[model samples]
Target: MIKSWLKEMEAEYRIEILFASETGSRAWGGATVHSDYDVRFIYKHHDVRSYLSLRKAQETMDFPAPYDAQGWDIYKAFHLLQKSNPGLCEWAFSPILYHDCQNFSSKLRRFVTESYSLISLFHHYIHLMDRNLKDIRGKAFTEKRQKQFIQAVRAFLLAKAIILEQKVPVMALYSSFSSSFPKDCTIVSFYQQLMEAKQSGELVSYADIEDAIFMMEQERPLLLELSYGLSKGKSIENELNQWIWELLHL
Candidate 1:
């Protein structure tokens, strides 16, 4: 179904897809049975004239329903890459690939770690955590209402890892925590239990947010402090421009 959809998109858009992958909860390995396939891709056009005008070409495309298929133009993707965009970085690291050009994805993955700013990535995750928490703030934390909490936890954990390790957090939640945090930590134990419950189709509530919130509070200041001290490295626009040209000409 996904492959057919991608073919349909290629035919409709007259662009060649260079890479495609599953993202969101599915990519992070925390999806439930009801999760939707958040399919994202990168594509390019052969027309050099389309990019030269003052009016920029559309940099994104989206398909509706059943499966959410969306894409970024290779041009826009590389532009965002220069800014250390977390979404692009996550897409590059996603474990579930529907379609990929090995050379393109592998090179992009390498570029992401080297070029991405730890401060920018940390703030991205922090923003996500803040947004998730806002969704459930001042509300009753019920079993059915645990989605926001779970998302908040994921974002907070990622933010913490990025600040402390001074690197991009792993896309997979379990792996990220295991690699950056202590094995015997309370948060890790809670996350493990939550995963078990999630897999069993059991409801997870806000009953266990004490440790999670505590950890977030503890790490918040450190993240802010590090963000101020760290320097965002050189922009990758030149390298990205070269890559985009090669793809267009290929």
Candidate 2:
């Protein structure tokens, strides 16, 4: 179904989708039975002449649910890669893939993993958690707020993995946490319980997430210190530029 959707999008937009994958809860291993598909993709113009335009073309497309399709132009994708954009990195590492033209997805996965800045990626997830937590603060535990809490939890864990493990965290939350902190089964068990509550339509207790956030907050200084101690990532602009050219013109 999603493949056909991508085909329709390609025909309508006259672009080649080089990579497409699931994002959001679906990709993160926390999705419930009612979850909608969140498809993210990267594309290049089928006609390279579009790149020669004086007026810039739109570099992104966003469609509404149930498909909830969104994509970046090749240039935009490369720009995000250059910044080690955590969202783009998740697309590369996503366990669920819909398209991977010319093995572009694997190429991107390896590139970001090898070159992403530890501090940048770590800070990205940390800030993400903080922002989401702020948005839900003083709010009732409605379904929307419940989702936000889960996202915050996931972000906090991912950031924790990055600083402590000195690696780009994996896309799936449970697997990433379990693998990164194999001895710490308590947090993993708590996460499982949280997910069960979420899936069962039970509003998870606010205190549960609050405690987790408090624990994460206590580790911030150590994570920051560890982040700086990790290697500064290499420059990837030249390589990414070359890769983009190949994708668009080859």
**Alpha-carbon lDDT of model 2:** 0.80
Q: Please give the RMSD to the true structure for each candidate, in Å.
A: 2.3, 1.9
Question: Stretches of candidate 1 above 4 Å error?
Answer: 53-55, 142-144, 171-176
Candidate 1 lDDT, tens digit per residue, 65-151? Answer: 758878999878988889898888888988888888756789988898888888788788888888877777668876555666777
| Cα deviation of 6, candidate 2, in Å | 0.5
Clashing pairs in 1: none
Model 2 worst lDDT window (10 residues): 170-179
Q: Candidate 2 at 190: error in angstroms?
A: 1.9
Q: After TM-score superposition, what is the CA distance of residue 150 in candidate 1 from its true location, in Å? A: 1.5
User: Clash number for model 1?
Assistant: 0
Q: Give the TM-score of candidate 1.
A: 0.89
Candidate 2 positional error at 95, Å:
0.8
CA lDDT for candidate 1:
0.76
lDDT per residue as tens, model 2, 104-168 = 88789888888888788888888888898899887777888878877777777787777667777
